[model samples]
Target: MQVVIEKRGASLKVKDGQLIIKHGDQVQALAFNTIDSIVLSKATVLTAEVVAQAVEHQIDLLFVARGGKPFARLWSPYFGSIATIRRHQLLFSRSPEAVAWMKNVLTRKMENQQALLYALAMPNHATDKIIESAVLKIEEDKQRLQQIEGAKLADLSPRLRAVEGQATRRYFQAVNIHLPEMYRFGQRSRRPALDMTNAMLNYAYGMLYGRMESALIKAGLDPMIGFMHREEYNRPVLTYDCIELFRTWADWVVFDLCRQQVIFREFFEVEAGGYWLAHPAKRILIQHLTDFFEDQIEWEGLTRSRYTHMSLFAQRLAALLKEYKTDKNKK
Candidate 1:
């Protein structure tokens, strides 16, 4: 289980070998073994003991800003075997196989989007037509990806992104028709979202970023190295690349909430910058995502929670990288 500390002035510490949380007049204690991770926003405070205990218990400590973007993380250095995996990761990042891996990732992402569009299709002919067209376009994009020829990811990255972007545009346009006008947007926006849907999407994506990063680290992969996403200073680009495969999960959650029309005016604050999810709205989104991720689903003849699926995928990727041998004679 994951524990979140978002209350203003909330404090976390260790007592009698148990995790203790105190906020205002309420206090709670939990066993260290029961906790998998701890998320704390800037408003919360933690003692050194808590950090030490978390590291000792191999629990991840994620710190986020008010906007729900994770800025820092703490985890046990002993979490995963490192040297061989990290070394293999660097070579794998530049290999032709990495290009194929990215194609598979993008293909799965578009497939999920098409599946969502189909699931959301209604009896209305016009809407069904839009959804059908979008699915066909996405299918075409997937075919283009399969046919892409590249010696390295750099050779294919631009074309891959262009095709993916076009397909994504069609998918979102289809989704827009199903949304209430207040929640719909002309396009997907980030940094500061222009509409309610984009705002919620940005926040949900931020959470997924953190989760993906954690999974990568625990699986002994270097999150900084990537295949499709360009390398940059201090960026976890591999997380960005892997995240594509699961972004539809967040999309489905946010879309469901908007369709329910349970959103209140106070749930979001609009500033000159953009829409910001308020504390209440953040809590609601977190709860929904946590429940959804923890629920079991069948895939590839095996049943597991969505969260476990991500973890296993990371482990499998790391294992593949470890077995990868660089061809020194290519030059």
Candidate 2:
């Protein structure tokens, strides 16, 4: 289970194989063995001992802002699998295969989006027409991806981005049509999140990004060196690159929550210029996403938890990079 510390000004430390959390008049101790990931959000004071213990226990420590976006992550520097994969990842970032990698990830994203929208449209003809139109648009993007085989990296990059952008727009439009007027949104908004549904998506994706970082690090890939995303100041580039494959999954989660009436209009606090989840509402959503990440999904021939799916995907990415380097050198 994910251990989330959301109390304002709370202090978290480690002692004698236990995680100790203190706030005002309350104190709690958690056994390290029971924890998989620790999330520290906004004004939470995390001690250095906790960092060492987390590394020792192979636990992921993530720092998220008040807006729920993960800005940084900490994990054991020691390699769990192949150490050379990190070195190979850097080389892959400079090759044409980088474009290839991004294209594959984006293709999966669009496919997932299409599947999700189409499935939602089923059993309810109200959304069928709009959603199917977007699904057809995604098919065109997939065909465009195939045409980029011999294109220059500079040329292919924008084309891929355009396809992804257009597909996302169409998808959002299709899904919004089913929502009631008060629950509808214009488009995807970030950071401050001008609308409620976008808020849910950004928050869920933020939490998922932290998990992806943990998985990438466990697979011996440096999160800073990535193929599709730019290595901006302190950005986790590899996490961003890998997240493209899972964005639709997050979107589906939000859709499910709405369908189940888990997140409703009354839950959002209207303040200033936009809508935001208050502390209590956020805690509820956090629990929801935690369960979502652990939920089982069919991968290939077998069923596995979503977390395991991401871990295996990262492990395979490492192996693919290693093999790509070997074949290139042989030529």
* Best lDDT among the predictions, by candidate number: 1
Q: How well is each residue in 1-331 modelled by candidate 1, as lDDT tens digits?
A: 8787777799998899999999889999999999888989888888999999999899999998766778999999878786888888888888888888999899999999999999889887678888898899899989988888977887789899999998899999999999888887899887788777888888888888888898999999888888888646689999999999999999999999989987765798888858888878888889988898889999756799888888888999999987888887344
Candidate 1 lDDT trough over 10 residues, lowest sum: 322-331
RMSD of 1: 1.8
The TM-scores, one per candidate, come to: 0.96, 0.90
- Residue 218, model 2: lDDT of 81
The digit string of per-residue lDDT tens for model 2 on 1-331 reads: 6788876889998777789999999999999988888999778988788898888888888888866777777777664567577777777777777787788888888898888887677665756777878899888978887677633344466667787888888888888886756567888887678887878887888888888888888887888886656536567888888988987777777777766666666777776766777776687788777788789989766699887888899888988876766346766
After superposition, candidate 2 runs with Cα above 4 Å error: 22-28, 79-83, 122-124, 151-155, 231-234, 264-266, 269-271, 326-328
Error of 2 at 10 (Å): 3.2
Backbone clashes under 3 angstroms, per model? 0, 0
Candidate number achieving the greatest TM-score relative to the actual structure: 1
